[model samples]
Target: MTNPYKSYLSIGEKLDKSKFILATFHLQSENQPPARNASASDAGGFDQTAGGVAAESSVGTWTDVSLQEKILWENLRGRVVELDEKASIIRIAYPLELFEPGNIPQFLSSIAGNVFGLSEVSALRLMDIELPEVYVRSFPGPFLGIDGIRKITGISDRPFLGSIIKPKLGLSAQEHIAASMEVYDSGIDLVKDDENLTSQTFNNFYTRVDEGTKRMKEAGYLKEGRQKIYAYNITASYEEMLKRAEYVVDRGGNCLMMDVLTAGFASVCGIRNRNFGKIIHAHRAMHAAFTRSKQYGISMLVIAKLARLAGVDSLHTGLLPAVFTRDTCLTW
Candidate 1:
């Protein structure tokens, strides 16, 4: 019996890595039809699914298309170069011409998009993307990198010390300010709003910026050489966000926090594009809904990379493990 999709598979072939964008996926495929030998390892089923993924993600469909009648597959298509059925992993490479330059959404759409919804594969996870240097250099990098942040915050001796304000929400504008002062006294250098916090009636954005900035300014001499930094949450409609960011900058606020996952990558790049001069703090709220599953959805490393390209000064990865404490020694 001939496998109709066998032409799509290129396992163990030597090729140029630079000509294509490579991605690795964890795959589980459904075994279909007469090839079902329960005692045999389902190698045939997995191979078909791999070809389907490469084709669906690049330039093929359920059946052959007329486009192939006139166009050459060499110029555009995804090639499956490696597979490990035991590990449930397969690597696919899409020609660079298949993706748009300087467009992250388009890149993701082609690679991490429709292939997930395919019935041929029961489980699939995008593990990572290896992009070319030209593609990587297309987008703007960090606005305020580590050295820039150190220059602004005057904390070059060690990493900044900060804490997430307890009681994630429900704090009045006054209460938020009071909490900020309390943390400052304990030698905390940075304080940020909760991810869900926004312009609630009780804690309006204008009121918080007006009052909080004054309090932050008064506490400027928290130490002999360092000043306090409050990362006010500006996660909202993109229009409203710009206005709020402008207000923060107008009132001399030194930092702005945004929920990168919910607000989208455009907002991150938008903030940096405006060059508002405030530190961009990125929060990954609602990430576990997708990233927590190893057999589904996007990778956190990819998210971090996009945020870096979009210009985030700081990002909350996760809480420290219980192993470390105040008494812990350091060697940095």
Candidate 2:
């Protein structure tokens, strides 16, 4: 009638097992931290920044262990209990002997998703406790992914042609609205304000959303019956973001955009989780710092999947070969 974990522990104790492997995960940020390059020569990987790779080191038995929970778990076994409430994290441990010496990487890989429902740090700690090959590859992408986007844009035969309302400098709401008209008329399906050009001087967000979307709708009606959505970027404190979103909805705007990087994961997820009808476009302005690394940081794929889970209707995966930017080969 005892717990399965308890049963596993009793067996380990009866056999005099000294080392138990623990996996801990740290969920400090609602969004995935950006990735950064860290030379392998350094012991602490990439100094764990907001959007940087975590430092990897051996802990336990070795007093200088970069992570100590591993060692503690080795001694505690089933005696240890864990919990993860929210933005915090959780950690889980197993008998180190449960894994093969050269297979720590596989073990972490197999349990990364589960990890006894622990924190990201807890997962990392497990690997630190008993080194893994560090295969941070995330889940298989979206289901109704690029094809779905193509179908929505009615551009399944080609990439979704889009552009931004440039001149991130001084521009009145009227002027911006004029630009939206041109972009839509010229055949662009999507148009967004520059990340820096939020509801600011001269071009207030409300004025811009009201007038700009009005112009976009006008253009769609006159052009080819296609509404080039002006996804007003609603990046702000949650309350303000929600207010803006509601405002956009009230104004007949069907698409909403948020700089997921700037707004934070909880904000994006909060909006998406609401299941709003707007197409959630993710603008990846500050993502370069995390995804630019070829060696250390996490991949954009992880971010994309998380966004999808958060409920983003669409996202800027990256430029394609058909465009000027390099074909990063992200989500279609």
Candidate 3:
């Protein structure tokens, strides 16, 4: 019997020099019927009607290929790189030229598009992406990386100490100021609002910023030559988010916190592009909903890379003895 994946292997080999996307998918037996007539050589052929094979015209038969079929076979088709029957894992390679530069929405739609809804797969997960240099260089990376962060905070030695205000919400503006005062007095180099704490009736965002900074100055924390960073959560509507960021900066607050996942990457880019001159602390709240499932959705590593590209000064990697599982924590 001929190898069913011959076409896929050939396509992959031909595109070896070009940029391509590497995606790992987990296949479940219940979703995919066993292949019957298909051999190893023909297995990689896209033929949805054929058991376990993706439906499409063969790349080898160019004469019979239609315009759509030709475009798909040549530019959009996913070439099988590896298949493990025992583990039910399949790795596919897709040419990178198919994707638009610096656009995550379009990039994801192409790489992780309709493949998931295939009745042949019970669950699908994008485990990793080997982005090419050209693609990686297309996006603007972190504006304030580790060195820049250290320069602003003036901590040359050891890891900088930071904390999140506990009891995430329901604190009034005065209460927030009092809490911040205690935290600063305790010598924590940085303090931030919880991801869920934004402009609310109980604690208005502007009031918190005004009160927090005023107390920080009056307590002599700013005069003592110690620059205590306060990252007020600015997660809100697109307009409100930017407004909150501006308010913080106007009030002498040097840092702004954003629930990056909830606020969306585009909003982050907007803030960064505005040249606000305030540090951006990225909060990964609500990330686990999609990221936690191993058999479906994107991974946190991919999210982190995207966040860095969006220009966050710092991001939450995870904390010890916390909610995240051991494996999940390690992955971050």
Clashes of each: 0, 22, 12
lDDT of 3 at 76: 56
Per-residue lDDT tens digits for candidate 3, residues 241-294, read 888888888878888889998888888878887888778899888878768888
After superposing candidate 2 on the true structure, give the runs of residues whose Cα lies further than 4 Å from its correct spot: 1-156, 221-225, 320-332
Cα lDDT for residue 313, candidate 1: 83
**TM of each candidate vs. truth:** 0.87, 0.56, 0.82
Rank by lDDT (best first):
1, 3, 2
Model 2 Cα lDDT, one tens digit per residue, 1-332: 21122212121123322444443334342332222242333212111211111111211121133554655644434322233435333334444544444332344344333332322232222212322222212221233355555554566566567787778658899998787777777877778777777777888889988887666566553233244567788888899999898898888786678998788766775676565556778887776554554332334665565566555667876555564234244531
* Most TM-score-accurate candidate: 1
Q: Model 1 reaches what TM-score against the true structure?
A: 0.87
Model 2 sits at a Cα RMSD from the real structure of 13.3
- Which scores higher on lDDT, 1 or 3? 1
88-137: candidate 1 lDDT, tens digit per residue:
99999888888877676777789888999987878998877787787777
Candidate 3: segments with Cα more than 4 A from true spot: 1-18, 29-31, 34-65, 69-72, 219-226
lDDT of each: 0.78, 0.52, 0.69
Better of 1 and 2 by TM-score: 1
Error of 2 at 301 (Å): 2.0
